[model samples]
Target: MSNFARVRPIGRRRDGRPIYPIKGGSPTLTEQRDEVMRLLQDENYDGDVAELLQRAERIAGEIELAQQREARLRHLRGLTPPGDPDPNPGQRQQPGNQPDNGIPDPVSAAEAFVRSEALRAFRERGLRGESGAVEFRAAPAGTVTTTTQPQQNTRVPGIIPQNPDFPLLVASLLDRQTSDGTTLEYMRDTSGPQSTWNKAAVVAEGADKPKSGPFTFDLISTSLKTVAHWVPITRQAADDNGQLMGYINGRLTYGLEYKMDREILTGNGTTEMQGILTTPGIGTYQPGSGSTDPKLITVRKAKTQGELALYPPTAVVMNPMDWQDIELDEDANGQFRVIANVTDPGAPTRLWGLVVVTTVAMTAGTALLGGFRTGATLWERQGITILMTDSHADYFTANTLVVLAERRANVAVHTPAAFVKITFAALP
Candidate 1:
């Protein structure tokens, strides 16, 4: 085999000199480095054939490296724009100028990025005819590049201010208020003690001036009540965000109105508004069987109560959970028994010819079905009103504002017998 085809030795000797190949074997480029080092240190060594050969190899290696550097310089020159000064004047250009395979240098890339970002900002701001400036900040070593500053130190997305409409659940179910806002007095006529006296039948046309009958009359009266709530917020919040104050006021009003609705439905009269649920003479139905069909009991008890009172039931109020059970009840064939389909935008609100009002205020397992409007009246002394002020103690000095929502209203059950409470046994 030819010497050029032989495999060369690798690595250095124990004496710190590299292991060179045997005669006729070609010296590897790797050995050129050691040969160059030897040439630098060995002053007394004469130029023998072997030494000359080693020197020649070292020189040839140097020439090859110079050629490669020239080629790289030529490539860089091609990339550099005309008339641009060198970034490192009077110093050797670092290999960082052109990383692996001619990729852009870090410093140049950063400058270009800054320019592009500045130009973009200028254009977005529409600052025509104005020059833009970019500031450079040295990042800590090993910091990952990011398009934006870290959220912890930068302006992150702020809490999306929430505005929810939790309007009164039961108020909407009540008949609309129509009272002229006049007086708190409500009057109803009642049968007197002798109002039920019956007349004796007279002989054909012979009436002895029907025995004088007694006439009597009675009256019923109810007064109005009120409800209110308030919220305090910074003036800056109210002023900076146009909707902030309005949202607070509206939410407070809904909260107050909702409480009023509950009070009107179930309040005890002692220190609270009188509601129909506690009114005297109101009917009550107990299913007593947890397994009893919800739909059957609801309609049957409501109709019976209405019949007894000589008035038909018009509405039913139940907890949303209880209503869900009634609405989702299935038959043996898997068909919806209480509600076949509900096209309403929200939860189901009607069932079996009665307006079904599902509210969180009503207790689960209990429902009220009655002629709500026909048997009762919602009297109003003053409608809902929203007011803002800095008049509260320390509010004006603290840059704070007070927002109030209030209403004056009362409920009167003219015919308590027209309403009925239907209670279901607890679920298993």
Candidate 2:
């Protein structure tokens, strides 16, 4: 008999691996085993470790069963060799075929043959999908294995997850509130006197009470703007739970936050929120001409300006470059200027008793010190929403899907005088 029963292949895998009869699965055991090993060696593999260990154990068990099955098939084939014919219709063993030992029962001798046939039949049922069976040894190497082209991404080892380092954000310092309408309207006490108290003095001897000019206010109205983006993915990718979640948590969600942060600080305000730097009436401080002040002193002077405006700054926002300069600054003694523990990673970033928020959103040469809790309010007409649809463009016909992320909000610098914009550029 031939070493292997030659039968047509069932089908080919996406990876160009051939699927054979006994194996009964597109990816044979070796393909799956390679995936687990590849993931273990991968530096970026984020899959659960325990699951892989369990899968390897199952694969080992299946391989042992395959070897046992091969032994049984060989024994069955040898019972009736090819080209041998049983000529008699009711063939019974003659005296020549009888056992050499005296008087062995015919029934006892037939028992061994019956048991072997039962095992072979049972194993055949498993190959036909009648029972739980995995792929087995069917390759030319005598060990089960599958091959794939290097260029085929459809049949990848495993879904590789993403981990991104989003920049330090400053939006958390600003007060947040939700709104129901598109337009956000509020009245600001724009022209408050330096001496708000004792505006109206008490009159003596029934004299007419002094009339303080009516408090001045300016109407401020801002329209909510949309921050939105979408990505196109294959329908198959969208259905993959790991791939979909990684896109949202790593890329799409990060995009929304990054755009919103830039808008809150430097948006043009015509098509976007009226960012703190663009809002009118806020104080501005720069190093005076001929003054060789460092970025650290400039930020401190800006904080004083906010205090002078009667709204002491609660937080300071600067470019990461500027913050790094400040953190690295040293006095003539060569000791660090800032007295805090420099090596403590968990320490909160603070400057002049105010919360320090460093972000690239703020220009490299500028900083903002403000009473963020009271100076500006972030109005959310709609919170961030994520939607998946196959109806976008030609995605439906092309078997593609769209993942969209959107949010609507406007920035209103209510007490404009409370914020101080600091220019760190050297003044001539």
Candidate 3:
């Protein structure tokens, strides 16, 4: 009986495992507290706690690094990680391998589960033939010879094939060669041979008509060498008809007179030809008819002085008031004057007279005027001179005539005259 008998079961075991006997049938409170304290004070306690904390920290770091690496890889592939319900399933996990909370790859998964065969079965029901038949049978050969309606040609008209080897015949006609070694021209005539003739020839002629000559011809002539003159017309006279008409009439009459004088000078020898005088009042006048009064007139004089002293003299003209007084004296310092005189007579009296005397002046001790002249005379000049009167008149009437005459003369003088001939030969 002893101490074991005295220690009755402190706690009954439900499944036959006996409870502790210290301190009211449970392990004693002091002993439990002591065990907990002993565990806290154990030698490996700090090491175990440190190992657990390190393991937790490592797990957290690994999760964070894995998420970062996934994000980086997605970025490199030009993709973004999908949201919860992904729009692009192809960017996510595959079908069978998808996790419980994983998304699917949109492109690859859709291709894998496509229903193409089902769609084909649906289309077959609408066709005329049986579901799986391959050949189409023609209508039975003329049981009653029932004629089917004719069908129209669906091809577009006039679209000729551009075959490179042969020319396409558009139309054809019936005709033969004539006696003059020429085939009578007909519509739709094929180049090589005639077949499927659709046109009829109305008449059969001999040979083809001879081709006509060239449409243009050329004229051959020498170029008339002449000088051009530019004359300024006032704006007022250009706008006025009466003033332009009067100026043109006066200029023409004056031009003709100058031509006569030039011809006379040409008749005379070079040395014998002295300076010729041109007066302004030498125009035809009618009673009671109003005409433009001449205000200025230019006179060109041809003169021959002697030969050169030492060096040839350059030509120059001395200024003059009018043609009346010709100054023969030279300057004291020996500045030689080549041209004898250039005079612009005052208004009506001298009438803007310019005496262009051809003379060459030398600069040596005995200064002399040379008379060697080259080229055509100045009178053969082709030029236009526009004059303005104080009175206003329209430009089209008489002014147009004057302008045309001047232009014609200029063209005749400057243009080289040449003739062109064209030769055409018929092929045999």
Candidate 4:
């Protein structure tokens, strides 16, 4: 064969179709064997051989990982329904883990229902486990020991024990009186040394004698004192049992009024009067835009054509020696006015102006009319302004108010002398 033909073919045939060599290289069996032996023997031929081995290992690792993921997916698909027992006893399961069975355990289901129902009852009536069934019983003549045991499940619907609404009711009652001043006074009575119903037990009829439980509502009156202003009650009375007996009902009122005094002077006249009216309880003037910083000075005197005039002389000293004195008087329209001088000169002289008077009146009495009016007016101006600077301000009212109320029935009976105790069976 020629040299070209002597070279080995670079492809192989499998049942007639040709399969090309990977790198266009073809070697005889003897040559391939010699090349493999040379690679094993040559220490200098180690350039990319380690890298190729590492790449092969990486591919093997990927294949193993893929196989593991496939195995996990198959295992997951084989899982049964919850509540179903595991097929293999040796296999461990997580807590709360149950078989895939559709049916839940009877015991667990019953317990869940009971718990859910109990919670529902507690929320519906605003009850707490510690509430309800205040106890009262005459002490036994002899030694009487009592024992308690956890009640077994009775599987009765709507029979689970719940917190009575009494506590919530009491809270609501106290909230209703939060704004009443008399409520605070009553609260103080409950807290004072002479309190009649402090730390007394309440007992309900048809119940076992309960273990001694201290009273809760006695000291609660103190909390009501904080918001007493809003409650605004005139009179309040409570019985020895810590119950509200009666109260005076009325609305609070407040307002502000103003009066102005003025006087007029003729050619030669003088007038004298008291200054502007002021707020009744206003101890000090608040210097601000809306407040009376520059108090209105009263028109003490108004004089005309005189060396010492009541007011500063406005004339430049040129006249025929005529004068009138101005005076403050009530006009026919009932409005205060500057009256003309009683005596007038033959010829009309230059009219002299007298001092002007302004007044602010704020009266807070039993009616609260002044304060309420002021509050309303200020509220209409957006909010009550206690004080304000060029760019800063302060207010008394807040953004919102929330009110809640409730009625409590058959509360515990308490007096200065003794207390009562009662108990009842726990709900299932």
Tens-digit per-residue lDDT, 314-406, candidate 2:
888888888888888888899888776658554566778887877788888888888876687777765455555555567667867676767
Give the C-alpha miss distance for residue 126 in model 1, angstroms: 35
lDDT of 3 by residue, 1-428 (tens): 45554554433333544445666456544444444344446555433556445544655566678789988877554453445344353343222321110111222211221212432342354244322211111121122111433222232232223222211111000010111111111121112111112233454488454433222222313222221222334534433433433333344323432333332222222222212111111111111224221111111111111111111212222222222222332346755323333463221111113212211111111111111121011221222222212222453233221121121110111100110011111112
Model 1 misplaced stretches (Cα beyond 4 Å): 1-169, 172-183, 187-222, 240-245, 288-291, 340-348
* Top-scoring candidate (lDDT): 2
Report the error of model 3 at residue 337, Å: 14
Give candidate 3's root-mean-square deviation (CA, Å). Answer: 51.5
For this target, which candidate reaches the highest TM-score against the unseen true structure? 2
- TM-score per candidate, in order? 0.51, 0.56, 0.15, 0.11
What is each predicted model's overall lDDT from 0 to 1? 0.55, 0.63, 0.26, 0.22
User: 180, model 3: CA deviation in Å?
Assistant: 48
Which regions in candidate 4 have their CA more than 4 angstroms from the true location?
1-60, 63-67, 70-80, 83-86, 94-428
lDDT, residue 204, model 4: 75
Q: What RMSD does model 2 have?
A: 29.3
Taking the tens digit of each residue's C-alpha lDDT, what string does model 4 give over 188-231?
01121123223345667876654532333242121111111122
Query: What digit string (tens of lDDT, one per residue) describes model 1 on residues 1-428?
Result: 66676554433454555565667676555566666566556665443557566666767878799889988886664464445456333222332222111111233222222234442463344335332332222222122123433222122231111122332245544443434343344433232112133344555666465553453222444445667787886756544322342343345645675687789888885456768788776778776555554655565666675666566787788887887788687778998787545463444346667767666778887888887765676655544554555566777678676666566667766666667788876655
lDDT accuracy of residue 78 in candidate 3: 45
In angstroms, how far off is 94's CA in candidate 2?
Answer: 74
